[model samples]
Target: MSSSRIGLRFFQNSRAAFRNATGPFRRPGAQGFRFQSSDAASAEQQSTFQRLWNSPIGVKTVHFWAPVMKWALVIAGISDLGRPAEKLSLTQNGALTATGIIWTRWCMIITPKNYLLAAVNFFLGCVGVVQVTRIFNYRRSLKDSPVETVKELETEVVDQAKAVASEAEAAVKKSN
Candidate 1:
């Protein structure tokens, strides 16, 4: 079977198990009434409910970030890499250090305003770095929290099932 079909089968089995374990908590006669419905109609209703309840909430948010961050990083890295080459060019002597010194002096003489501009750029770059870090961290936390929540929910369901089973067993023993 395809992965999605396998996933659907697993989901259906888990939901059925959950329902069976929590049967006593449901309204009296609800199960009997539900089972009397036409099979196709019931299946359709169950599928609709599953789609509504089980859809992941963060997928759209992740999709929005994926391309945005990818392009942002690519552009940022390319532009940053070009900065040094643009500012410093090789001299006729082919001395890299001398060329860099010449470029520094040239920048100071030709664009005194560049000092302020550089400061502003540096500040903005720092802000961008922090923002990107926070977004990455937020995504990681979002990924982790849901898994933890699902595990906790499953544990609670199992515990409730065990409690119900024990109660039922005790009641049966008493009746006998």
Candidate 2:
């Protein structure tokens, strides 16, 4: 037999194996319905997630939250950059934690047999906590560090005072 024929035979056998494992859809009463493509306008109403996800506010929120969540994922190290959707900021992390808690509760309620998902939810919440603390610690250390200037401490202090005075003067004029 030719190489191409052999390859085709292999493909046919694999297809047969797949079909045998699970019966084709729309076969009969026990079988599932056949898949069909449908336009959005003519089809069933969109899912809650799909509706919100395509909206302007949803787009903006995902874009903004992605960066913050990315940073947190970086700190976690074990997490994948592409996983969990976005880099949520500290505030967004709170939302994420709440989501995890809700999912855990849902899994517990829906199926006690599937405790694995609940465990995953618990881990998700922990990651959010760690991410928030890491962000805070990093920011606090960055703020306290004296790496910005070559000038002495006193010169830096004097310069800041002048800047504050000028800002105050501007504010006073603005109020007039």
Candidate 3:
């Protein structure tokens, strides 16, 4: 009739109920639920997507999403095709190239072997190489033709100065 005795009785009943619900196969100290035949059959009836959702490299994991997000870099590189080669940074492209090559190989070496990651890295490496080549060729051409390079530099400076002046004028007009 004591509070402690009532708690003990409740605990005993709960344990007995759980044991009955779980069936006779489970050990007293067992950690997890043991699936019965019905449970096993239901698991076997799981859809492909449900199976994939629980898989090691499935959508629930970072393994499936990292490469998906990294695709933006590839798209950005492709978009950079329209930009002048002289504007591209040699260091940036070189870093991308190195990262792509290194990760591409590492993807294959890692457990679960993400082929999608490998493909993305390969394309990223190709884009980086192309950009690097363009920058190198542009610099080489500038070095080859000193007079043209000087003219080009002067044109760029003048254009930038004009753009700044126009922006300042617009700001003044807006203030007025």
Q: lDDT for model 3, please.
A: 0.81
Which prediction has more favorable TM-score, 1 or 2? Answer: 2
Compared with the true structure, what per-residue lDDT tens digits does model 1 show for residues 53-153? 42232223332244344444335533543343323222211232233334435435642233332333343344344443443344446556756655654
Which candidate wins on TM-score? 3
Q: Which consecutive 10 residues in model 3 have the weakest lDDT in total?
A: 29-38
Per-residue lDDT for 84-117 in model 3, tens only? 9978876678779998999999999998899989
TM-score versus the correct structure, for each prediction = 0.20, 0.31, 0.59
What's the C-alpha lDDT at position 52 in model 1?
Answer: 38
lDDT of 1: 0.46
What TM-score should be assigned to candidate 2? 0.31
- Once fitted onto the true fold, the runs of candidate 3 whose alpha carbons sit more than 4 angstroms away are 1-44, 145-176
Candidate 3 shows a clash count of: 0
Lowest lDDT 10-residue stretch of candidate 1:
88-97
